[model samples]
Target chain A: MKLKVYTDRMSQPSRAVIIFCKVNGIQFDEILISLAKRQQLAPEFKDINPLGKVPAIVDGRLKLFESHAILIYLSSAFPSVADHWYPNDLSKRAKIHSVLDWHHTNLRPGAAGYVLNSVLAPSLGLPLDPQAASKADKLLTKSLSTLETFWLKGNAKFLLGSNQPSIADLSLVCELTQLQLLDEKDRVRLLSPHKKVEQWIENTRKATMPHFDEVHEILFKAKQRFEKQREMGTVPKPGFQSKM
Target chain B: MKLKVYTDRMSQPSRAVIIFCKVNGIQFDEILISLAKRQQLAPEFKDINPLGKVPAIVDGRLKLFESHAILIYLSSAFPSVADHWYPNDLSKRAKIHSVLDWHHTNLRPGAAGYVLNSVLAPSLGLPLDPQAASKADKLLTKSLSTLETFWLKGNAKFLLGSNQPSIADLSLVCELTQLQLLDEKDRVRLLSPHKKVEQWIENTRKATMPHFDEVHEILFKAKQRFEKQREMGTVPKPGFQSKM
Candidate 1:
């Protein structure tokens, strides 16, 4: 039974899972779910994931959703690559888990909100509110400040220790890189007082360059979609952006 | 090395960790961090967790934060109770992991938000906004619906499966039981329009009656605190509520 992943390059989590697989040299079939087409809501996809979210996988008889869970599964299933990706040291694992939790509430939500409001929402013909933009800016700033204080406070290069890059780095870097593509104006928020984070971003981008050319290309297309949607005045597509 | 848990009974995650230890017969010392006294922000506690979030545990030289990580650690350390609580089956474990992820974003946030806005906010002498109340309502409804759809769709008894309870059930039950005493309005919402979820709630309550009693007592006191603050004409606690 081959491992199959359902995803869209436009979603950061999907990209993170893809990058993780690529870095580990794991072979898996990719089934792209187009966010613009609302392909995720289709009945065929819904059977795999009742929640109708992407980055889901079916590994033989084992089916899983949630990017973090899939990351862990891949790590356990492929033990040879696990040390570089997940690390077995208890404290290092804790550090990874802590950042992952924080990502869900803070960075992920903020970045996604900014992208959706500025790009996806507008593409769906929804009215963009400057107030929400300001709120997203603050959320991103606060999230960055927390990362600066908590993770990047010392001279630590990676989130965990000195040199080794863990799954935490991969997950976070993918999300932050996506945030940097959220239009030029919105991306300016990334250059706040977080010098350490800025340096880390530079480091991660360099590390990811060799393996993630395809990912970068996909994200570039997503940025292009954002721009085209804005120019075409197709702000807020039907049956896509929930009014409530 | 003894495990040390910093907790407040009013916290759902803290309670879940405590229940895990109790069920497993693992000995641990408890240091209650008073949310009301703002002890979590003090420099002393900040040394351990700069994020200052609870259900933090220290075992020997290793310290772990985030309830899921702690639960995973405890399971690895105590294999005897592991099968009963976390389960060794790969697919079952994946299912639990997926639900745990859902718990963080869905039920945990929405339920905690409702308690904060409706109960905790007022207790700290802060102003109440009906807008937050409505958002909390929508979030809770959606979360519970998904919980029923994903976690409780088939089992209806335990989150994992029949015959025995798992960590997923322990964590989710704590969230619902904690909310039951925090706000009557939230309790009513759990009952109406979510009969499956409500049934699952009762099943969990009946299964863990003794532990529920112990945790419920503290939550009941919290309810009193909210009422006292409401009588004083303040909705949200002044310093604790988000200034933004």
Candidate 2:
């Protein structure tokens, strides 16, 4: 039986997993658990993942959630993929794990929270909490600064200072891509200070290519819808409030 | 040079790393970074870890932070250690990673937040936010329920249904151990409902043994100090407030 991946492109982790499987040529059925409809909370989805979250996978008897865990499992379960994605050297692998672990508390919150508060929340008819947005902005700025000064400091193109992109790059860059939902001015203001980060995003995009664009099409459409609604001075009907 | 581990037993992750090293007999020098003194923000330690978090390790050229990262690095770096601590099987390893990844957003917040708000805040001269404490309590209760229903449902000694304990067991049990700082009545009220979690905690303690007790001595002392202060109607001076 082929692997089953339940995902929604609206989620950064979901996009990351989808792109990963596509890039690696992993055969899997893509089951859409629409975040816009809050379908992840459905009982059927809950059976697949008791946490009621998306980007879950079912392979034979193993059922897994948590995108990072699924990514690790995929890398190990399918040996056909290149080693650089999840290296064999103990230290390199540890470094990647470190980056992934750090991403959850560090990069993820800032990136995800900023987009959600500044753009998604308003677009979704949720009360726009300025305090929360500003707090998220501060965290996002600090995280971007750290990305430049620490993770992406060296000559390498990727987070681990590696020549090739790793899952960390995929996970993080997908998070930053959510910034596209913001107006150009807001997006530039939040992201322009970090030149290295901008370049790294481009680099990751180049490496991932058509698959990146393909998986991100949903976000692009959402961005357009949000922009159109803003221009008309109208609020879009609330979509699923993603618990990113 | 032996591996240099910077830790404070007051922190759960720090204690986890210390106990892991001691039990595995991994040669290392323990350098105490007092969280109370804000020593993690020091320039000297910042050089070693830009994040400046406890439970960081400096092993030759590699400087790694994040306790879970450290645990994975150690298990792989040292071949003499038992494999069950971090197994080699693909599915088993993925299961452990799932727990660890799930831990950051789920268990850690509830476990760590509850302790910090209900106990650590008052002890550290910070105003106790009753509202925040209540919110954390709810989250903690929900997490404990999930632990019982999902992770510990099977008749197994530890998480992952292994006869021997894994790092997931250690990391989680350590997080819950923070509850000891609470008053006796509150601790029992919070813990009594989850018999499986309690058993798992005991199992983890037994598996890890004297090292667990040795590393946890600081928490025990702090609990005693708080109880004594309560009895005498005196407030203890604020110690360190950990951000974790």
Could you say which candidate leads in lDDT? 2
Q: What is the Å distance of residue A216 in model 2 from its true position?
A: 0.2
Which lDDT value does model 2 have at B209?
Answer: 92
Residue-level lDDT of model 2, residues B131-168, one tens digit each, is 56676788898989889889986899888678898888
- After the best TM-score superposition of candidate 2, give how far the Cα of residue A95 lies from its true spot, in angstroms: 1.0
- True lDDT of residue A36, candidate 2: 74
Which parts of model 2 are misplaced by more than 4 Å? A122-126, A235-244, B122-127, B232-244
- Fnat of every candidate, listed in order: 0.51, 0.89
lDDT (C-alpha, whole model) for all candidates: 0.74, 0.86
lDDT (10s digit) by residue, model 2, range A1-244: 9999999999999999999999998999999998778889999899899888989999999999999999989988987778988988888888999889888887888878777776787555577655566767788889899899899968889987799988888988998999888776678877898998999999998998889999999999988988888678664233312222
